[model samples]
Target: MSSNRNDLDRARAAWRWRGQQRPDFAVTPGPGQESVWDYPRPPAYVPDSRHVSVYAGDTLLADTHCAMRVLETGSPPTFYLPPESVDMAQLTPSDRRTFCEWKGRAEYFHVTDSSGRRIDNALWRYPDAFDDAAPIAGWFACYPSQLRCFVDGEAVRAQAGGYYGGWITDELVGPFKGEPGTGHW
Candidate 1:
């Protein structure tokens, strides 16, 4: 592997929280709810059967029951929808890209509505995801901050920071990583 790749591996290994124990600051989950602190370090791809939908104003962008939720320690779940369930025609490939240690490289997309309103880098996908993240390859995940998102008929809230794509619903509890003073987490 290249030096850069080795450096990335080291960085990924340096995380303090690996989900073995929840910190005191983390909220205790209520009945029927989950704590993000209990999620694993490398993350888990859990198949979600709940209704998931995304919209830009009146234009429906994606709707699906087959979403893969990536649950990682200290962060809320990021839901990825199947390609067939998303309206690809409204998505234009963007030049932006990012890398995740467990998921590999991600390419972004810009969403355009019927009324010509465009949200740049609103969605992303891992075309050649690492083996552990292969289940979500070619699937799409949008930023709830940029577009309206819902799960099981409940309006989704965007994760605290502008960076994370986690869709927060009522069933999940967190002192989520993206919040202020969580940079080290």
Candidate 2:
């Protein structure tokens, strides 16, 4: 109980530092678009049936029709695919781990292609997700900038900062939070 309270306090402090208001420069959603600012806090995990694909240059690493997307306020969506759809041969477990107050501990993976080129800590997964984030258990998500990603046949662009692994697409409009000076979204 005390640990949970401490965790909640830390999360609240982080959010306070990141501010709560949407920036004025944030794009207004037009037809068929989503403004990231409209997303929910604590994030939402929802099923996405779109065909999602990942590639390391020309090597196809993952392709799946079943995926989950995490939508959080001020950030672009991060899509996660089931492990079965991914080429497990291409991934090597990394010692890196990160914590999320809403989820739990996240483990990272290093991706490598057939050509032997490697992207360190390019993938992440919450092996032990919190009850509310259980939907993402056993799923994996990658950094679009490290490996090419496509959603419904459209190529994805990586969100600005190296820390956040959100994939930016035409349907997502933003003056996104991961960019410079947005530490206080």
Candidate 3:
């Protein structure tokens, strides 16, 4: 007799097989492909069926239900989702830029409330990512102070400690791959 584990695996395999047929819109670049001097990135996004993520600071902050992608731009790998996942009224642009070899250049934004509280530049987006990863042209990342993280409507903490801005998922394994490990990976 086969266990439910086999049934689950079959279902997952079927789903994954179906997904590969479609062209991936995300413009994610493979490692070492980025020009550290030029710094432009287009990325390949791994699709997340469980797309709703949020960051709340004692309030109802960002919330959305769509596909999610991880940006590998030599900075911090950030969680990027469709803009519709977040309420536009609560966000604003911030004057911050981080340099990345893989993803090109990045710009940041902050969230605010009706009460006039500022969240600072807790979010970011790559306006024009590099060649391999361009589908995520406008999605943003939430910095540590601006919001807490949640995926698939579940409240989750960043696996990466002290990574206020960078969002962590099953795919983008780090803390050992990059800094904190002194770039050994």
Candidate 4:
């Protein structure tokens, strides 16, 4: 099948699966943190100030400033944000790195904050990227499950799904593609 056909099929299948999802739907927001139901997002991705975190069993993960918005996806909209908002004192640099054809090369990290909190390379950033996404340069981001959320010192959570990154958010939606999302995106 052509790539275009595959994309369309994937889109349709996702839409159907979403509409047919069980009302008792469940998802893991972070390690050992599971929640029921889905989170709603706005259309056309409105840039807004947000906060998010990554945690491991009641432990505070990394918290950072963010921008949240819903993007077009059969699953759910994803929130995107900048790295400066994140406190890198908790992250450890990892040799692991990859590249996005459109975004450019990305570097990863294993996190351990100044408070000694830990979350392995659950965060990533594109040191250099296309001009369009350049605003996010140097801004690190983490998966919802990798960390927890605390916006304005208030604890918040996200919808269940491994396919999302709540940038500038803790209640972000999905489906997000990390690995293998490369090649002419």
Identify the leading candidate in terms of lDDT.
1
Q: List the residue pairs that clash in candidate 2.
A: none
Candidate 4 per-residue lDDT, tens place, 1-185, comes to 22254553553344322222424333435654312124321123346565545454465544545564444322333444555555556667998876543345778888775566666767777677546456556666566556665556655444344433543333433343233541111
lDDT per residue, candidate 1, 16-86, as tens digits? Answer: 89899999989999999999999998999999999999998779999999999999999889999999999
TM-score of 1: 0.96
lDDT of 2 by residue, 76-184 (tens): 8999999999999999999998877777788999989988998899999999788889999879999998999999999999998898999999998887888788884
Query: Which scores greater on TM-score, model 1 or model 2?
Result: 1
**How displaced is residue 92 in candidate 1, in Å?**
0.5
* Candidate 2 similarity to native, TM-score: 0.91
TM-score of each: 0.96, 0.91, 0.60, 0.51
Residue 139 displacement (Å), model 2: 0.5
Best by TM-score: 1
lDDT of 2 at 161: 87
Cα lDDT, model 2, residue 117: 94
Query: Residue 6, candidate 3: how far off, in angstroms?
Result: 49
lDDT of 3 by residue, 1-185 (tens): 12255653543343211212212432343564321112112324666566555654556666556655554333334567677677777877777776444455688777876577787776777788755457666776675435767665545445343443455444332232234643311
